[model samples]
Target: MLNGGMKWMFLILGTMIGAGYASGRELWQFFGHESVLAIALFTVMFSICCYVIMKISYETQSSHYLPILERLVGKKLTGLYDLLIILYLFTTTIVMFAGGGATMEVLHFPYWIGIGVLAILVVVLFFWDINGMLSMNAIILPLLIILLLAVLLLFIKSNVNAMLFDWMKQSNWPAAFTFTALNILPLVAVLSAVGHQIKHKGEILIASIGSGVILGGLSFLYNQSLIQVAHDLLVYEIPLFAILKSYPYYMVLIMSFLLWTAIYTTAVSGVFGLTARFRDMVNLPLWIIALIIVTVMIPFTTFGFSTLVAFLYPLYGVLNLYILASILIFPVLKRYDLLS
Candidate 1:
């Protein structure tokens, strides 16, 4: 049970800490500059939301997000939200691919090359199916957490005094809600597809708490690190690289690879959401559908990574708040049999 929960826990992390979060763009967009309260609230709210969504999905033993989404929004609004979920996944996955281009562009690789590499990788992964994604998440997420924390801790060590002033500001608390909202669609898209795989309520509980604590800790540290170098953000498209700038060349190389991997994982998750949604209708293998979908998206990556994140991330965040609210309030409603 412990091991099983850990796998799901990592999946949650892999889903959340992808291209935008891993790259620091998504976190910065929502919870930055005196966001201590925001992060705290997000951690609690996010954990509760995760447990609620997973429990709903697991109980339903759902293979798609439609049932879980319908429960939250009801039949009246389900079709509308379903369309939104698909569009959200498509746009966000494009962001990830754009992010891949941005990541590679930092290392002097051409933008299209980076985008191509990630698209190829994701399409290839679909050949192995969801198990491939699960296995990859298990392997990559641990290193992602470790390496990300290491960089964050190192930044904190060099500027312990900076965090003192940083933690005192709390005006950004409200941003937590929107941030959580921005992440809601993908969480619903990914976890809802795995409902039947969840073995027990304990697994949901463990995965929810573990991912929340882990992401919260990392987000806090990473946020602090970014605050220290916030001034340079204007010049760097990927703000995480600002923290990595002072490191040795080899460390920089390693982190870049990890960052790319972060982009890859998120891209794969986004594609999973899309492919899973249309798998039945396509009348083709999931991989072939993924390949076609990804190919069509590649042209859009030219819009640039930071540009897409700056515009789309917050817009979607605002849009997803209603759904986020539903997820948060679900347990209370369920107790009264309101949803059934």
Candidate 2:
């Protein structure tokens, strides 16, 4: 049961720590100075949201996000939110693809080659179906998290004098909502598909609390590191590179590989959500569906990595607030039998 919970927790982390996030761009975009309270709020809210979503998914044994969406927004609004989720997945996956390309470009690989390599890998990943993605996350995410946290901690320790301890000026607390809302769609999309696989409610508790704590800790550390390099942010497209400037070239290269893996995992998750939703309708193999989706998304990567993230992330963050609200209120409503 503990292992199963950890597996789901890794899946959630894989879905989240994508290019924008692993690269430090997403964290900086939504959180920065005066965000101490915001990060705390996000940690609590994120855990609650995860628990609610997992509970609904487990109860319904959902095969896709639609049933979960229907329950959260009701049947009347499900269709609308369905379209929203589809679009959100489509665009965000494109951002991951672009991120893959961008990460490789840092290693002197051609941009298209990086995107093509990632797309091929994503398609091949589905040949093992859901198990492939889950296994990959289980292996990769722990290493990624360790290296990321190590770097963030090292930077914070080295630059302790630059660190701000202002806890009261938390005007950016509202960003907690937007950031959590930004992540809700993918969480629903991925977790709902695994509902039937969930054997115990304890797994949900473990995953929700575990993933929330890990992500929250990483966000705070990464945000602190970025704060010191705030002025250098404009010089680099990936803000992580700004933080990495003080490190060795080999460290940057290593992080570049990890960043690509991060992009790859999220891309796989996005394709998983999308292909699972359409597989029954198309009556095709999951890998084939993944192939078609990646093929279609490749052209959209031309929009550039940072550009796509900068534009779409905040927009979806705002639009997804409704779904986030519903998830937050779900347990209360369900407890009172208000959902009926």
Candidate 3:
């Protein structure tokens, strides 16, 4: 049970700590100075949301996000939200592909070659179906988490004098809601597909709480490190490189690898959600569905990494607020329904 829970936790982390988050762009976008309170609020809200979504998924034994979406927002709105989720998964996965291409370009690889490689890898990943993704996350996320935290901790240690604690000026607290909302769709899409695999409620608890704590901690540390390099942010497309500036060249190369892996994991999660949603309809192998999806998404990667993230992320964040609210209120409503 412990191992199972950890697997799900890693899956959630893999889905989240993608190109944007790992590159420090997403954290800086939603959180920065005066965000200590915001990060804490995000931690609680994120855990509650994850627990509610996983509970619904497990109960329904969902094969895709549609069932869980219906439970969260009722049948009438499920179709609309389903489209929204499909779009979210599609666009974000493109961002990941673009991010992969950009990362490789930094290492002197051709951009198209990088995108093609990532696309091929994503399709190949689904050959084993869901287990491929779960297994990959289980192996990759731990190392990514450790390296990211290590870099952030080292940065914090060196820059302790620059750290500020101004809890009284936490106007950015509202960002907690939007940022958490931004992630609800993918969480639903991915977690719902694994419902039948979930053996017990204990796994959900571990996944929800564990992912929340790890992500929350990473957000705090990453945001702090980004804050120290706020001025240098404009000079680099990837803000994480700004943080890595003082480090050795080898560290930059290592982090570039980390960033690419993060991109691959999220891209895999996105493809998983999309392919799972269409598995029954297409009547084809999962890899074929993923192949077709990636084929369609490749051209969009030309939009570039940061551009796609900047334009789409905040837009989805705002649009997903209703879903976020519904998930947060689900437990209360479930109890009320039982009483009635």
Candidate 4:
């Protein structure tokens, strides 16, 4: 049970840690000084929501998110949220594509080439399907987490002399709700689709708690490191680069590759959710649907990675609050027999 739970946990982690979270861009956007309580609230809230959503999915043996969506918000709001979920997956995936292009731009490569490479890889892998994608994330995600932590920790160590500023304003605690909402939609799509395989409730417990703790810890540390270099943030598109001020050019190159991988995993994961949702309806191969989605999304990548993230993410976060609230309140409603 523990072993199975860890695998599912990795899947959850891979889905969550993508380019936005790994690049320090997402954290800086939602979290900063005086966010301790906010991050803590988000961690607990996130873990609970994951458990509720997974348990609902597991019990229902959902093949896709629609059935789970009905359970989450009932039949009345299901269609509304379903459309939102599809749109959420599509746009977030595009942001990941833009992220890859932006990462390559850091290496002086043309942005289009970077987007092209990631798009081809995503479509090709879909022909093989989700198994290979999850397997690859299982291997790569641990290393990504370690390297990212190592980089952030190193920065924190070397920058001890740097002065802190007005980073602890307490008003940011509420962003935790929106941030958690932003992530919860894609999570539902992915986790729900795997419900049939999860046999034990214990696995859900472990996966939920384990992923939340790991992500929350990383968010706090990464946010701290970014705060130290907040002044340099205006110039660098990817906030992860701010930590590399003292590193050799080679190390920067390595980090950039890691960032691109983060971007790729996320793009694939988003497309995976999108494909899972549409596969039954389209009378088309999953790969083709994915190709169509990616093709339609490619032109939007020119808006640039950071720009899309900056503009779209917060909007989605706000838009998702109702869905998030529904998920959070689900178990209570179910327990009281009020949801029917």
lDDT per residue (tens digit) for residues 242-262 in model 4: 888679999899899889888
Predicted candidate 1 versus true structure: per-residue lDDT over 54-114, tens digit per residue: 9988999988899999889889889999999999989989999988888888789998888
The C-alpha stretches of model 3 lying farther than 4 A from their native spots are 338-340
Q: Cα RMSD (Å) per model?
A: 1.2, 0.8, 1.2, 1.9
Across 245-321, the per-residue lDDT of candidate 3 in tens digits comes to: 99999999999999999999999999999998999997898898999999999999998988888899999999999
lDDT at residue 274 of model 3 (Cα atoms): 94
Give residue 261's lDDT in candidate 4 (0 to 100): 84
Extract clashing residue pairs from model 1. none
| Candidate 2 lDDT over residue span 210-275, tens digit each | 999999988988898898999999989899999999799999998998899999999999999999
* Pairs that collide, model 2: none
* TM-scores of the candidates in the order shown: 0.97, 0.99, 0.98, 0.96
Question: What's the lDDT for all of these models?
Answer: 0.88, 0.92, 0.92, 0.87
Candidate with the larger lDDT of 2 and 3: 2
For model 4, what is the error of residue 103's alpha carbon versus the real structure, in angstroms, after optimal superposition?
0.3
Task: Provide the lDDT at 28 for model 2.
Answer: 89
